[model samples]
Target: MDAQPDPVGEPAGSLDPRAELSEFLRTRRARLKPEDVGLPDFGRHRRVPGLRREELSQLAGVSVAYYTRLEQGNGRNVSAEVLDSIARALRLTDAEHAHLTHLAKPKLKKKQSGACAQQQQPVRPALRGLLDTMDSVPAYVSGWRTEILAWNRMAAAVFGDWGELPPQERNWARLVFLRPDYRDLFIDWEQKAIDIVCMLRMNAGRCSDDPRLASLVGELSVKSEDFRRLWATHDVKEKSFGVKRLHHPLVGDLSLQYESFRLTDGTEQALVTYHAEAGSQSEESLRLLASWGTDASRAGSSVRRTA
Candidate 1:
């Protein structure tokens, strides 16, 4: 990451993902004071902490001036040597180290939509087949980026709102935070939003360099202040399986447990299916919802596509 700062903006259309990742890492590091990490926080009234450029330089075993240049994105040749030392000084976990390495590496300049980029949206045929077969349960396939690729009839019933939403707003995660109807649909709106935001943040980190992901982030950041704030926290958690409580307009309050499995052969989409404990009142409610969703799907059939 060594080079003089490009004026105005990236000579290309936008800022490099490396630039964004670097900024995030620097901000996160600078936010922590020495005392926050058990070192003395005695600088009285200073700028930032955890480590100053000089301190980080010492801890990372690199020269202060050189580190500064790297931070400034002027160090065009930041080898693995510097990154490894920096990770050690930051007490980074394995995942963090991997993310750091990703940030420092050269951009994958291949076209964002191509044979290699197939994983970006190539929903597996097998997963799609599974979704169709699971017409009895609320099931759908979505990629990490929260795209509603494909869903069974039952999926539409439980998440009926998605069926009504235009293509631009079919995102369950975004609706959970910004849509008025969605906020009121869940009895525990606050918790639901938090979980969705956390999951979305995790996906964003996993696909930070993706053009579609960048667009999604920009849209959500502009549309919801809550989304913007949650995103800044940098929390990452995969939400594959969980129990959710929702007050469906048609089926009343119901609890459903969902499980997600990543598809290996087809696309990078995850197949998520929601089920209720057999013989329980919640299960009965889910069945009713399933029936209603099936009826609706018949009236307005649309194929779900996942990438």
Candidate 2:
């Protein structure tokens, strides 16, 4: 029997879990200080920024040699207890802890026999209908890799008509980094960038075998220096809820709260919706924006009919 070739046109290779685990541990360790970990801060010329390998090993109650091997990216023989102790020593958050676990013990991928190209994420028609019904809210459906699978008119009005963008350019990461208009749209662009990069980092941990994700990461790394810096930090964040402060060209300032709910259809799909506080100026602005979007949509429809 001969080995089969990988799927055709897979432009990027899968992320190396060993390398990811190594960098993740190193970055996490680099951010901590001896004093912060309740260890004695010896006033000496130190080459490294944070606690030494030996100090960390001692804190985790493991042999220096074992901890060193794990930090060197050999997590093949790591135990659950050891991982937990090391996570505590590193002061990892819930999200970071999960990311660390995923990196250290990634699930075995099933052998691929045929086409392995990334499939287009399917958005349920009902979900799309739901988005359309949210006339006063800006809502959209995000699938794996944060792809904008479907969106309502209000979302188009607030976030720019994603329908106008080619499918590949509809991602949040690309829009945030590659689009200049988005930089102006987001009042706190740096924070938005950080959040996006962190989300990608978390996704990378969970979906190491996703070739499209690998390609996306590679593209951003090559094209955006800011992305490169943030990616190197190995930070991870789970998207749940947040407040977005946007400077809409037509509506001025908008402070909108967004909530994301995971779809229960056994898919990695989430419905994200944004709304303004009740009786607030932002709420008034949102209503005005919705009206403007409706009018524009009507005018476009009329023009198409005339043509």
Candidate 3:
């Protein structure tokens, strides 16, 4: 039987850096086999699922003792070259490699007062104006932890009005997992869940000390089994661009392609916009939805979900 996902034993958002690094490397190592690294797999029964410490160290050109200590969560003295070598050995993607580096060399946390820690990041007026100018495109600004800071009318029409939701509930993680209506809106709910969890994992590595993030992770871990399972996979990815299929209550169906651009405003905010292909049925449905304008309030009200 597969091992169960470890519980969020620490308080929400307060994951130990060492433990995070340890589990991430272990999960990554567990997915590989000796044959994967060109090593002969003798018919001897294996004691562990994936490559052993000696095998990985040999592949990475590092000492077995050092690799063992690093895998055991003592990565403080590890260098970038060693990390890069190990990343290559594990065949980690760019995003996964970056996540590993962050876990190993976390930035110093700034002291935050109670109010400052919980304060919401405001979308710049210029950025908000840019979102508004994208008339036909459904656009929104997301801050750290996938918080929906600002959105345009088209976005509200397709994804429900974030303006109506409390700031805490205006997050992608909360909307996708906590709200039943949002779950039903996605055609591939499992894929959507995986994407959201991957985003959260990225955020956890980047801002592991954010208490609000910890609290959100803790709450989701306790409330949603799907969240708990996906969270344990140690997957790290950014949803920079993708196609999403949705079963909109009013529009019937929508196939939208989205692009995410990072803002250069010295903050961790991204501008995400969605558009359907020109002259396609999805385009027509999107156009019709946009035409609903303020009237889409009715559809939003119909599918409004409560936590």
Q: Considering summed lDDT, which 10 consecutive residues are worst modelled in model 2?
A: 108-117
Candidate 3: 10-residue stretch with minimal lDDT: 1-10
**Tens digit of per-residue lDDT, candidate 2, span 148-242:** 87888888777776665566777889888987778888999999999899988887887777788788899889999999999999999888898
Which residue runs of candidate 3 sit more than 4 Å off their true CA positions? 1-13, 108-119, 304-307
Q: What is the lDDT for 115 in model 2? A: 17
Give the local distance difference test score of model 2.
0.79
Q: How close to the true structure is residue 149 of candidate 1, measured as C-alpha lDDT?
A: 68
Model 3 C-alpha lDDT per residue in residues 1-307, reported as the tens digit of each score? 0111112234344667788999999999989998888999987887878988888999999999999888888988788999999999998999999888878876433221122244445777888788878879998887767778788888888888666665567778888888899888899999999999998898777777766678788888988898999999989898799999998877788999999997766567788999999999999988898888967845764665532
The sequence of per-residue lDDT tens digits that candidate 1 reaches over residues 61-157 is 8898888777775535788888899878777766566555544553432322122233345455666677778756888776655667677777776
Higher-lDDT candidate of 1 and 2: 2
For model 2, state the Cα shift of residue 81 in Å: 1.9
Query: Stretches of candidate 1 above 4 Å error?
Result: 1-15, 49-51, 54-61, 74-76, 79-85, 88-96, 107-122, 187-209, 277-281, 291-307
Ranking by TM-score: 3, 2, 1
